[model samples]
Target: MKRFYIYLLAFLLPVCCLAQETVIIKRKLTNAVKERVSVLKSDNVTKQGLYQALWDSKTVLANGSYTKNVKTGIWNFYDTKNNVIQRFNYTTNTLLYEAPEDSATNCRYVVDHTVRDTDRTTKPIVIGGRFFGYINYLRLFRLPPDMRNINNEVVVPTIELLVSPGGRLAEYIVHFQAENYDRKVGFNIDYLSDEDKTFIPATINGEPIACRIFIRCFLTSGGDLDLF
Candidate 1:
């Protein structure tokens, strides 16, 4: 039996209901290419198979039912493994449940969560017109003076990248105390005089939405940086 439980997401609606069961899913996913659906079968004269075939052909980002084009009912979102990573209620436009990030979260998996900002249709490409990927972005990292002093070692930290809907760099947070750099290496993104946070907007529905980009940054001792 496929059991389905509906619980209001506490973060989205704290007062909806107090008696709630929670399922924490922490996993990683990579966006897979859209699959091509087979030809419509209505012309083939099978009426019974029409609806089911259409449902199978649908490839909507937010899968749900629509009444006169207005979204309604529950929608289940899937990951690369076809697992339900997230489920939302379109009637309220509220999140019902989402999987939490696990130790296995990596670039190899399909990203069903915004913890890495993959929901956006576009990811940031390399400065020189290279494709959008973590490894490509890391190669462009050239650290400022305060990043490190060690010659060959590297410091990895959780970086919070914020950008405007118009694709301008808004602010960045570097966890100075992260990894092994307690006080030896640090720089304030807030203090930068030059505008450095330029990025590719994560767009959807033909419009840009502000999003948070979180990634592990490797600040090398030779003024080089790598991101994983």
Candidate 2:
């Protein structure tokens, strides 16, 4: 009887340890975004549970789950105002829902302005969705040393992204204007990561086409860039 009890305890120990092996990690992302990831350590460390990205450490920007580090099931992405902007299903590779395009919100333009308004057009979008893409942009953007402190004045800056039909970033330009400052900065796209350069190319009349995306942002006195 003692040998049998010992064998049973040994058999259950590994299972109990595995059940409690879940690890939670929290980290800060660019622009005050917070990421909380739950991973499981078994044969290897894998993200196997809830994943959340919060904006400003409070508003939920993204909420989803992962299996084997791949996004699975439905994922919800929200705007800074906490409104659901997109719903995607990674398991099925489907865009379940996307908010209607509002020109007042984001700027978009086709490379060829000759396209008629009646034509069906879709704007280019970053590969990993908007929240992550915005975060990446914030992480890479660096303010010029002289422009870092605005002294409570609002400074408008425009970021232009020229995307090719192949979904590559052909050109990146930044335009800044203030009381006595007017500068245009261009970056070599080759220096950017492949993931950053890739996007879902814009389409016109069901055909892929090159386009330009303009992101309007303002620099606060605190030196933080806020997108409109």
Candidate 3:
């Protein structure tokens, strides 16, 4: 055990020593765009260094290698408002991660969840605003925003997914008090067809809480179910 600790320390010490201590500059790409570059942990200290890039004060790319201060490999890019525009993933000389498949059923759900463009229960109905547009139906029912907080003082929201025979689609219901910022967003997702309903259990920190759920429901044309 003592020998193991010594070996571990020896291996990590160099990494710690080579870590860059601060951000040297924050540059604006344009009136609406801002970015920062900072030196961070780097491998191959003798020949290379690594740096991190931030857009709109958000760390979009990290551990970017530089050969004698020349940028190399994959780097992240952001939009003018600091939203992630594209991710450049590089390994030697190849590209991975293909764009999502396009299908009539799939496209409908995509717009329903992520963009909340339309409600699945009601055909040709659209909902506008944040959490609107399309989303992956299989992955709907997101946890409360406060659930991410480390303090654990806030209450987490619960989600339930349901599918119906009429729509032949998936839907979700979120249950939680509004005090903790509990809000519901539904989507069409991929899942097993055999199960009509599913209740997934989750937690917020150590306290027991149901966070998100994924389910399917039925949808029929000529019905207007968009209540709001």
Best by TM-score: 2
By lDDT, the best candidate is 2
Question: In model 3, how large is the Cα lDDT of residue 22?
Answer: 43
CA lDDT of 73 in candidate 2? 96
Deviation of model 1 at 139, angstroms: 11
Tens-place lDDT per residue, model 3, 46-111, is: 224445444335534223455554556764443223443334443352222222222422222222
The window of 10 residues in a row where model 2 has the poorest summed lDDT is 219-228
> Candidate 3 versus the native: TM-score?
0.25
Tens digits of per-residue lDDT, candidate 2, 25-134, equal 88877556789988885543688899999878888888899888788999888887888888878799777877765656755565775778798888887744555565
Clashes of each: 11, 0, 31
Listed in order, each prediction's TM-score against the native is: 0.30, 0.76, 0.25
Distance (Å) between predicted and true CA of 14, model 2?
8.3
Better-scoring candidate (TM-score), 1 or 2: 2
Candidate lDDT scores, in order, read: 0.41, 0.75, 0.34
**Candidate numbers, best TM-score first, in rank order:** 2, 1, 3
Query: Where is model 2 more than 4 Å wrong at Cα?
Result: 1-20, 40-46, 127-132, 146-152, 188-193, 220-224
**Preferred candidate (lDDT higher): 2 or 3:** 2
